[model samples]
Structures are given as C-alpha cells and as structure tokens.
Target: MIIRTQVSFSVTGTHFTPSKVPAPFSDSHDPGVIGTVGRFRGAPVPYGSAGFEAPEKEMAKIAWIYERVSPYKSAMRDAGAEHCTLSVTYTYDSQCALSFSQEELKMIVDLDCYFHVDCQTAT
Candidate 1:
C-alpha cells in the first residue's frame, strides 16, 4: 500500500537593522521552486507537478522577511551601531508529496516554515 503526505512549515525571526540599506533589494517573494518528495508504503514518490507556481502574495512576504533579517549580520568594520532588531516571520506551504525517498528527508529542514524573532543585538 502506498500513502502520500504533505508537510509544510513557516519561518520567523528578529533581524538587526543595518547601518545602511543593502544594495540589490529583493522584494519579499517565495522561492520559484518550493516542493519536495515523500514516501508511501515503501517506495519513492514525487509531489506536485513540475514548475509549480508560487502565490504572488507569498513573494511579498518572503521579500519582507529577507529585508528585515538582512541587518542582523554586519561585515563592515563600522556598520552603523546596531540600530534595532526588527521582527521577521513568514510561512511557506509545501507541495503535497506522493512518495518517499532518502533525499527528500534531507530537504525537509529547508522547507518553507514559519520564523519567529526571539532576540537580537545592536552595536
């Protein structure tokens, strides 16, 4: 017997504000490809069709998360003193899975999941 399962999650966190706005600003957007595989009974199965379409609204959400979290890390010697850490969070829905595979398990961690801002530091 083969069984299918669909898993989904969200990502959220607090990102420190950068001293200056970073270049190449990417609008909140979900990844073009955001699905994986699963197992049924005992065989490998695929999920969703090829070239899945992401929700338009999701793009905005993703961009927001990325922008808000960008300031958490500082590479410059004098990146403006940590101004403030902004709360960031986003949720991603995984495409349904029809089969299971070892590779699929490895990809689970990267799945679209909710993120919560726990804490942060400003220099």
Candidate 2:
C-alpha cells in the first residue's frame, strides 16, 4: 500500500536587519562642512520577518518520510521479502507573516526509493 501526507503552518520572525549607514558617516558631523556632512535623520526602515508556514512544511515532510520508510522496511524484513520500494510526495501552501496578508510562499518536494534484500538458498 502507498501512503501520502500533506502539512502546513504559519511561521514568522524578524529575520532581516535594518540598513545602516557607514560608521564614520553615520556619526555626528559638523554642519559647516556641507559636502562632508551626512544626514542625521531618516525614516526608520522596517525589518523583514520570516514567513510562518515554512517550518510547518518542513516538519510535516520529515514525519511523512520517517513513517513511510521505517514501517515498510520492517514489513519487508518480517516477510522475508527480497526487495521493496518506497515513494513520497509533499506539497506546501503559501506562508506569510501575520502582519502581511499579501505575501505568499510555496514549496513542494517528492522522492522515490527502492530497497533490496537478498537471502542465499542452500545449493
């Protein structure tokens, strides 16, 4: 029998850094030196946060892989089977931060496997 599973979740975090001006230019500068002076005030840049859904997808995939492989291998051994094949498929939904509704991300993965076991028969 073949089995498949799909999973999803929302993941979010502040993963991006705010842009900063160079060290010397960022510090206080004399106003009289117009050409050399740097602007002291600017709009606060918004840092980017990680999307919430990625981790969920990763965990789901891992669980599915483990479940499918381990049981199948055990079954094959118990049955004294010479070979077995395993396959996996996964799909991910759009992931976005709670603050942003328009942002979306998606990922998908698929894998296939073949296992072989051999037993020598008495001649």
Best by lDDT: 1
lDDT of 2 at 106: 19
Candidate 2 has a TM-score of 0.21
Q: Which segments of candidate 2 are over 4 A away from where they belong? A: 1-59, 89-123
Pull out the clashing pairs in model 2: 10-52, 11-51, 11-52, 11-53, 12-52
The clash numbers for all candidates, in the given order, read 25, 5
Q: What local lDDT does model 1 show for residue 33?
A: 25
Give a tens-digit lDDT track for model 2, residues 1-123.
112233321111132211221211112222222332235235332222111112233534434443433433333334333322332333223321121122111111221224212222222
What value of lDDT does candidate 2 attain over all alpha carbons? 0.26
